[model samples]
Target chain A: MHRRRFVTLCGGSVAMLAAGLRGVRAEPFVDFPKVRLVDAAGAPLKAAALATNDAYVFHYPLRSFPCFLINLRKPAGEPREMTSEALAYTWPGAVGTQKNIVSYSAVCTHELSYPSKEGSEIRYAAEASPLSGKPGMIVCCAHDSIFDPAAGAPRLHGEARDPLLPVRLEYDPAEDAIYATGLAGTWLLDRFLKSYRRQLIAEYGAGVYKEPVGATSAAVLLNTYSGGAVSTC
Target chain B: MSECINRRDFLKMGGAAVVGGAAVTAGCASAGPAAVSAGFKAALPRAKGPRLVIVGGGTSGLTIAKHAKKEYPKFDIVLVEKRDMYSSCFSSNLWYAGLINLEFLADHSFLDAARNNHYIYFNATATGLDRAGRKLITSEGEIDYDFLVVAPGISYDYNRIGVKDEDTIDALRTGYPGGFISPTEHVTIRRKVQEFEGGLFLQYVPNGNYRCLPGPYERACMIASHIKKNKLKGKVLVLDANPEITIKKDGFHAAFKELYNGIVEYKPGSAITGVDLAKKTVKTEFDSYRFEDASIYPGVRASTLIEHLGLMDAKSPQKEALISQLKYNYIGDERVYVTGDSRPHPYSKSANTANTEGRYVAKVLAARAQGKDITWYSPRTVCYSMVNANPPEAISVDAGYVLNKEGTAVGGFSPDTKLFEKRDAAKGRGTLEWARGMYRAMFEG
Candidate 1:
């Protein structure tokens, strides 16, 4: 039974509080629900369009080249299990029994290369060098940063300090399409909230942004929107 | 963005008309009747002090003048620059990507920077070097210097690419601009790229050590990204004179493969022999192909100022001004210093190194003015190459130098001083900060 907690982080301050648990799961902090993963022509992503080891790159909520989707089912290979604990949501077996497919943020945790298309020419981990040993590894071509998609896209090598953030996938069997419902991390969520907050303050007034519930502290938002110019040292 | 707009608006409005090519502006204006002090305004009370004359007000020159004034209040510093404005080629790739405006790449007023620092800003070119007389000859008059620093960047050698005649050179420059170092050329390249309507977009990279090693590759990425994003039906062909990539091999090769894919085509060892202006065709050793528009980066060397000073040794095939590592002094004269891209050194020819040397030279000169002992200082350089277009993520090379047994600055030995070649997502984010930080320190500090 996973517990839900409100985590608040500012420029240099952090605090968290647990809500009364009643078998409720954590809500997706990242704003992936509204974002439609699209092809180069801005059309919705279809599950059948991707072959095994094939993936597509798209811009998500905050930044361009944010997320990517991969089809894990191979022609003559055994079905592999998803090893990533970062998977927030998955396609139900009833939806054409799709258990081997997954999607992860294309932005590399190491240097943010957007390996989906900007970083490398290879389409899948199985095609890349060194990382080819792993079944679901995605390589960030910029620094050779590798991530294991089956295991929540964790960093396998290179300088990326964190794993690729996972986006919750929802398969619509009727449309044979996959839509991103939510995300597993606070990276883009925090940026979105702070940017949204700034836009709000600029459009309305400072008084109108009345510190919503479960919101990060104002100081944290200030630093997030500060464009990284404020030097702590 | 606000500050950038405010400072750059004037340059967009007028700076374009004030200067032509680097050559046209390398002559001096008439010397005014009054003996202007440091501000270049009017006659002021003359004081007996050691004079410091710096040639070329680029990164190194400006930095030296600003630091020298702050350090030694008594020394008279004179900055001799050909143009009133400066266009930085350091981050011009961003401009090509449409991430930054062309106006932001140009600085309209070194005079303002000098005025604020109380340094004499002379809008003139240094034509000849009278090393024996300890004077610099310009169109206006001869200006004497107690200590001289030359930071006159680089000049392209068109003849190396079979462009011998002035008409052919001018045609090549006007038709296909090599947006390597100047502002006007950068704008021309930007306009050409922006106006490109889905055709064969060709780019030529030179063979030898150029201004920025990864610059051509980065531009190719940006151009391909723009085409891909806009859904423009075109192909970007990169013709390399060298057999392979000269630097950042892994990252660039990956970028070409992943991001551009079908949109970009890379051809190695395709050295351009000549270009047919009438048909827009580029002839290489291997093949001849027609191009809709092109960016041809010609072979580069130290600025003409170095040639005028007779700093290059005659026997060397590649002409570069020889200089000491510690002093950055011209090989023959200790009092005359040649820093930045103009000097031949193992260190990369970059603005960061230039700025580092500028500050160091200023400190060394201040110590010399005070009759104090000065020691060698290692200069460091950092270059950030942005890979992704929209998100603006970047990779970088950070290198530091240390004095060798012979006192020449070479690549550093220790772990902390060693070259950092790997890319970092954090470093990608840090690129903008690094650029902003350096610009702020150089201009606003």
Candidate 2:
């Protein structure tokens, strides 16, 4: 049984499992209002900014997570079933609209290069989508590293030993705002977060509000965003 | 971290630490910010271990000083810098595009970095080097050292671009400031952007290996992003000396076309031959373009300080001074080590590379002091470029270098680097992380 599937069967929600595992150990975890999906100009990341298979690069100052929002609202033929928590983290493009908006960290586990930023597009389901090719795929140009975002951004190609990091997002129904809740992946971002916080405090003071909640446990982060919700093995 | 830890307190602490006694004390000085502006006293207490003097308290110099002090505190370390504050050339483009504030760009108290590391911080500009005597002559006075590290950074050749005569040079310096490496230069460029009310704004990218490879392109993207977001009238004319985009070509070009659209006018092979200060215009071989405001970057060379020390080989280009591949030491003198942008080593002149080499050099020096040998490790660099604002995508190139048996460093991905546009925003964010991490490792870590 897959670790994610086993956990999904045991816990009703992956977020619950993550919450239990990371609440104590996480280094300042981000939640609603604290983390907002913002575009390049620091505006709220919206559904309209992206189309089917298209991605919008989203980031907040002080956090070095190379994250992208994709509209997986409508799959090729049969819609792949996913849990609400997984959908909320990454699904459609629009918040609350269930536009099948999804987001993932583009930082390659191998060398930290974001493939999407270099004009590389995401891969969709083919006539017969491979297990690795299902969901969504991102390819790196440097060493041809492939990641399946739909299947928790698992490594499908190249030298990347681990799957692509997933960025967990929360959706607001009324405001149509997408808030980044947490992340599940490599520990490359913690150092960047510290630097960002220091600068923010130094320049803007403590009053300015731009806090990102970072997950402390690598296992918790990986399990939370793995295999569309948790299921017992 | 101290009760009376001001600039004067730092200098006093440094001096006392150098002397090494039960009590650390010094004369009282005014607590004004300009206290260190005048400069620290030339007379510093001698150290027990070998003294290492680092010129130019930038990434390379600071990194070496900090690492040396941390690893072996007994070793004496002194860092010399001309400016009181350092404005980083690494990510100043973020400031130009309004992504980050100028405060984020400028480091008013890099002296604090030295102080925290227990290294002597001298706020005096270096005037000349006495290689034979192992002494550095600064504005304050002469300071002797057992080992000297020259990392003064690069300088521009204004004469090469037909900016002859002091008046023309001065005009271009003030009017069209090339905000490449200097913090003051960044301020000049920032002000120009803020005050841009319309008309043409020209930014000419120089040819050859300059400070940061993606700097000019990133600046153009930032400027263009500002123009489009602010809804400013007119366009940003990016005139490049190279025939095409030197690095991250696809990403930058896509950014220009998809993000800024008509707001950015890019012209390749349009190198700046001459600048008319009176008219605020620049001329290329094919055509002459006028600008209301501009930042004309001429070709860069090693700091004149390296040349003055007679470190450069006669066969080397008049621009950069050549250094050994395995050891960053100059071929003529091993005691006087040279690294960073000033070195003629076949590596990209970048902050990342400098930061890596600084620590590496410090280790090498430490081993040498103990009569030990360490393997020569090659340097690595990662450069991130933010192409667009709204979509907020960023691309990057990570270069891992290896020195061949022939004593030449080879990076398969040279000026022909890789890119990552799809998750560019992530890369953009990574840029901040990388810059912060590198800067921290250099000064604070």
Candidate 3:
């Protein structure tokens, strides 16, 4: 049976599964204020303009993740399935007590991973856990690690051995949303790497298929975007 | 005509260089940032004061010294070298391809640029490093540093595969794409090429990790092209340890198929086991054959210096396990940095990466000059290979460039200037330009 499915058959909600896993989110992991704006440039960029910017649509890979920032005002509220590269994260500031409201990565620092977002927070669906005390936040579904978003580190639960790879965010009040300002350079899903390895092994287990990663080829991807991704077995 | 005049002037004035020393002045002139005018200029390092010791004086070592001094000129920059002169390994393909002369393209001394910076240059080999004491022990004497940069290039291990002693290795290096750094040995290479009759000329690639991944192929193409030009009947076999031929691989495959026509036999997944140098015979696990001349390109490991410093993963006696220990990021402490071909990195060990690593380490060292906390980033490189006079193809990659992963530059050849844009070097002028560029980028402004 598929690991995720077998776990579900054992009577666990998607929420509970997320709890068991790290780097995933169910809900209450992210907080979005009702405020709205057409656009904002607080972090040297207009938030609204960034949300719909064609540059973000494709070129987001330049930011080196599956990350994206949305403008609340212009947010189609359509629950847009993010097909872009940037793994959309909340803006990079805590407006007072709202520090834990945003979610981040929970992969190990030793290795980096590009885990996509499951809910409001970006989670390695294989290794799932919340950044703070919030439920449904996944550090990585592959490895259940937790990170503290407010503190920009790992929490007691989840892949606590690893920390959240923090992506810089900025809130543009004009757009009533946030924009991805910078990257920690290592905010990859360090936990999900195992799943990716497994997937590759399963797919190319003939042992003849050799795919070297994380450096030169990684350097190649750093220069441009390739629309293909190998699934984690 | 104008370009030729400039070359002639530079060469003729090359003698005046010892006297006039313009390259050094040009190197220092560009030290100040163009942004802040007077204050920045005043704050620049005064070409004298604190000893800025740079180990390895190759691309990275020299660049960091120059760039570091530019930011904090009050500090004295001292560059140390084991060799008498500095030449570039990048664009050295021209030498192997018979495209350029080694004398013209692969020679330069840092004395000119060192004088321009008023920086001290030491001609000595670094024997040991006391990272704690911040002192570099050289053959001449021990030199202390306020800050140090190490770019030791590559140290090849020919002894491991039974090519023991200098004479045997020297005989082997005759005409095979000779090793990088101290590139003066190519003079013997030309003789070996002329001596070879009709027999197999083998490029026996050692283990996987080596200085330049594309080097073997680039060398092969050059030899094959030369063989075709000479209308030779002998076959050139490339016994590779890797699964496929790399470094602008797709393009090389095409060229090999269409151009070489059967002169070059690419034997990937094959390696040489034993050699009877006296009998002029070599044996591989796949098959045994006799070759007139062979260039055994051996596997490269980290330097003894790096291992002694405990920079690598600690291994057990059986080599079964690695000790769980933290590795240093951004090259040891802020005091000392390693770049170029010395340190183990992900990218292909090429000249461009070395130059870029030199620039990056220098940039970080530069930030430290201004009382700023510097965050260092990994170096990037794009290699361009022209397979036997065809328009070159490229492979571009930048380490630590992306957020989660990395990528490559648009590859393949084109008449349009968008992709593979770096291939636009003037036919005759590329090697010299590359060497000059590395010097200017590293030594000068």
Candidate 4:
């Protein structure tokens, strides 16, 4: 019930401001207008109705950025402190009646390979994958990076040095709906934008890719979103 | 006017020093009359901090240049490269099968990488090194540095193929260029694949710890794909000097049987003894074969720059740099380092290995600059081989190295190493992205 309060109480804003003053290319944390999570039909999605087998893709904070919404079949872990090259912050625990829902930035911290329409180098494996050899792990086949989403999405193996950026979520019990509020590890977002600027511009029109997602953002299953081009490894 | 001494002249003066031992003697020879008059300094903005100079613009140098600045912002880095343009030696076989274009390998700009990471990209060929004086001699002029990294990659040893004479070696180099080093060779090999009509197209695999073990086998598959696509009567003759395929053997063998069938012929343990250029015939220990066209890959050694700069290990069979395996610093010298394929480690000579190793070496430089030290770690080698071109199926290997029992040098592959020898379309798709990710890591901030 008080999961979101932990982020502020941990002095995250102060740490972020300090990081900003260090002249790092990007801010450690970024806040965006709360966007209701809607299904393809533009209806707010119920948190309990979300699938427990695979991740759902949603554009959050920016039009080109992709995030993964997952239902951990079980209650998520407690809030914990995590550090990356960009900044240090507390990852708020999962939210919902059972506290079994979570989300993270799908872009890999290694080289920013994200789930695209053509195919996704990163995917959620409900069953054991050859690379991760464990279920409920996010695997990036491009360079064999694995992350455990249930445990704050810490890096489990391979070349990635940092965890997946956390996408803060809010669950309204009255409406049984979920919303995306803020993002941590914004430094990677800054890089993903600069590194793939040309392709993003070609896809979303010049400057449109960087525009903030409006009041509501659509969330779709990774399988449907990538057209079944997900890599198992 | 500044007196100029090129690499050729320096090599000529140090020819006897190589055999006589002690690189210090070679330095002594170059320090005579010319060293006093060599007053030119490379036109560069003065170093704002501890000047770090990196020689070579390949995967190793580029990654270190960018990451070193990130690890230690106080480091003012300079990357000195010979070529004005950038083209990757990795993933070059894909060009032969039309899976990728030249732009994919060459479109990354050195100038852009330097600008994005806050460093300087100086286009110059390193001619020599004055370790005591902390000066890097280049074609343009000299550069003073607090630290230096030399990563000049590899060179072909034609003598391993029994072609010791300069004339025959020249003939083989031009007539059957190995598509492993320069961009010109890649271009020539691609043209040969496109123009192949109907005969034996030879792809030779050299012995020893050569660069890109899967390269020759991968090229054979690409050429065989071309031959099969055009329904040409020619076959790709893979002349492997080893007893079996060096790496990812099952995947390549499967492709040879399932995909290429009659188009690819594999010959193992066929070390080339000589090449008769006039007759287009190659002689191995037990057999001689004729070919319509060929890419004669000879054994590899550290780049000739290593020996020319007097950094080569006198006892190293491959003429690699004489540096400490853990720190990559020259023995008894902390100011200088050697990395990349020129390293004596048995790790796969691959882009991925160098990229990861360069990042570690950058950390080493950053720590040493601060008068600190860190423990050593191994580099990872992630390599992919395209086995089929029509639908694009591939296999890959992810490996990490381990230290020896004495905790000294790289021993062999780590236990966590895994091989995806089962070729599939998913891996084929992964192969392309793997290269793109590598390019991004080396070229972007």
Top candidate, metric TM-score: 4
Q: What are the lDDT figures for the candidates, one per model?
A: 0.59, 0.60, 0.44, 0.84
DockQ of 1: 0.02
lDDT of prediction 1: 0.59
Q: Which stretches of model 3 miss by more than 4 angstroms?
A: A1-233, B1-48, B159-178, B305-332, B369-371, B390-436
Candidate 3 lDDT tens digits, B320-355: 101111111222256655555544333346665566
Higher-TM-score candidate among 2 and 4? 4
lDDT, candidate 3, A53-95, per-residue tens? 1112111212122432222111121111211111333233332
> All candidates' TM-scores?
0.60, 0.63, 0.52, 0.91
lDDT of 4: 0.84
Q: Each candidate's chain A: what TM-score?
A: 0.54, 0.50, 0.34, 0.88
Q: Identify the runs in model 4 with alpha carbons over 4 angstroms from their true place.
A: A1-29, B1-37
Q: Is candidate 1 or candidate 2 better by DockQ?
A: 2
The order of the candidates by lDDT, greatest first, is 4, 2, 1, 3
Candidate 4: deviation at residue B309, Å?
Answer: 0.7
Residue-level lDDT for B96 in candidate 2: 75
| Candidate 1: regions farther than 4 A off | A1-233, B1-48, B403-405, B409-429
